[model samples]
Target: MVDYKLELIILPVSDVAAAKAFYDKLDWRLDVDIQGEGGFRAVHYTPTGSHASIIISNGLTDAAPGSTRGTYLVVDDIEVARADIASRGIEITEVFHEAQGGIPSVNKEGRTPGLAPERASYFSFAIFSDPEGNEFILQEITTRLPGRV
Candidate 1:
């Protein structure tokens, strides 16, 4: 069997500089920034403790800016992560757990207030978005499901 790994994700942004600034504020590691001929430019950033990195560039895809959503970043502690991000001046949604149905709803309506009562991994989450409206969810996951690792 072939091994597959997710290394990069391309994010569309209306302004490259603005996006760069936003990610910088989040304290993500700036991996590279390259400019090429014909108005080409690429910027790569990796969040702290994340193996996968995100690429922001021009002339790479036709996707509209801010159209990307639901990207997730897993953490061991949702409250600490949320507070850290919020301390950086980023606005974050309140922490929420999955509703009684065992699946997160499509929007805020499906979320119940506060953390998961059982402290279940992958059950708690908080949401935030970049300046371009690219949404990201921070999920608390202290353990992985069987074979996930």
Candidate 2:
């Protein structure tokens, strides 16, 4: 078994500058910005509380465009959060129910579907892909224990 805390998601891009601009527009804060070191350039960003880190890099040994790499950002309110993100021009991915305890559950198509709903866990989430086509998700958990579905 492996104990994991912090995570790093490295995304390769053809144009690092363009990728940085797109993420910036989303109001995603940028971390250390290093350009031109040993033929590698990188820019890092992490959501609040250091849930996960996204690294935009160039001149990497591995990784290609449209490579799927992402994380889940938990949210409190899925509808409100999805609306806010939609206003920002990001699209949600899927809304489905995970069965537990012989009960059926539902969540918004993108940012609201609570993962493992039967567990009564809060995990309202939304999925979005970067400009380079790498997909990631934001999740928010509100309540614990099953609610009236």
TM-score of each: 0.93, 0.67
Residue pairs with colliding backbones in model 1 are: none
lDDT for each candidate structure: 0.87, 0.63
Model 1, 4-121: lDDT tens digits are: 9889888888788888888999989999998889877789999899899998877578999877788899999999999999999999989998787354557677798889888888
**What TM-score does candidate 1 reach?**
0.93
Weakest 10 consecutive residues, lDDT, candidate 2? 101-110
User: How much is 28 displaced in model 1, in angstroms?
Assistant: 1.1
Candidate 2 lDDT: 0.63
